[model samples]
Target: MPIHIKADMAASVWKVLVEPGDQVAENQQLVILESMKMEIPVVSFSAGVVITVVASEGSSVLEGDVLVTLSDDGETG
Candidate 1:
């Protein structure tokens, strides 16, 4: 099954750490968001392969927005 990464709060995307196809470990930082003068990191909950990154730097995102997707084996299809 695939895992969806969502924004926890409304913020501007600060940075994307991994691109699609990158192998990631559990708790790896995927992106950082800037909100209310604070930086928030979005992390993976388990080891997996990045499937997609829907967020770009400088993009504004709202809470619950889907930012990225990952699979346990790194395959999207």
Candidate 2:
């Protein structure tokens, strides 16, 4: 199974901390979003390997937009 990390609101991507093939733990920061002059950290929901990054740094994202995909470690195809 794959988990999607989505933007909670419209914002500019400040940074991407993890890339494809990187291992991430649950509640770990995946990316940072700048909105209203505030920086928000986007965290992962499950422990897994990063499969893809849909949003890049300096990119603007809307609410509910997918940021990254994670391949769950315990899941099987």
Candidate 3:
């Protein structure tokens, strides 16, 4: 199964911690978003191998924007 991680709110992407082909665990921080002077960490919901990273640092992202994709079976995208 594949999972798509999305932004929960509109904000500037402050940092990205995962990349394609990286292994990620459940609740691991994938990206950080900055909004209204607050920093928010975006975490993974389940363990998986990252397939893609779409968010970039310093870019504005809207709510529900896809930030990362993951393959739960350890497959590379």
Full-model lDDT, candidate 1: 0.92
Could you arrange the candidates by TM-score from highest to lowest? 3, 1, 2
Estimate the lDDT of model 3: 0.96
Q: State TM-scores per candidate.
A: 0.93, 0.92, 0.97
Candidate 1 accuracy as TM-score:
0.93
After superposing candidate 3 on the true structure, give the runs of residues whose Cα lies further than 4 Å from its correct spot.
none
Native-to-model Cα distance after best TM-score fit, residue 68 in candidate 3, in Å: 0.4
Give the per-residue lDDT of model 2 (tens digit) for 1-77: 78888999999999999988888899999999999999999999889998889989999999999999988974322
Model 1, total clashes: 0
* Strongest candidate by lDDT: 3
lDDT of 1 by residue, 2-76 (tens): 888999999999999998889999999999999988999999998998889999999999999999899986676
Number of the predicted model whose TM-score against the real structure is largest = 3
**lDDT of every predicted structure (CA atoms):** 0.92, 0.91, 0.96
Quote the RMSD, in angstroms, for model 1: 1.0
Clashing pairs in 2: none
Q: Please, what are the lDDT tens digits per residue for candidate 3 over residues 1-77?
A: 78999999999999999989999999999999999999999999999999999999999999999999999999996
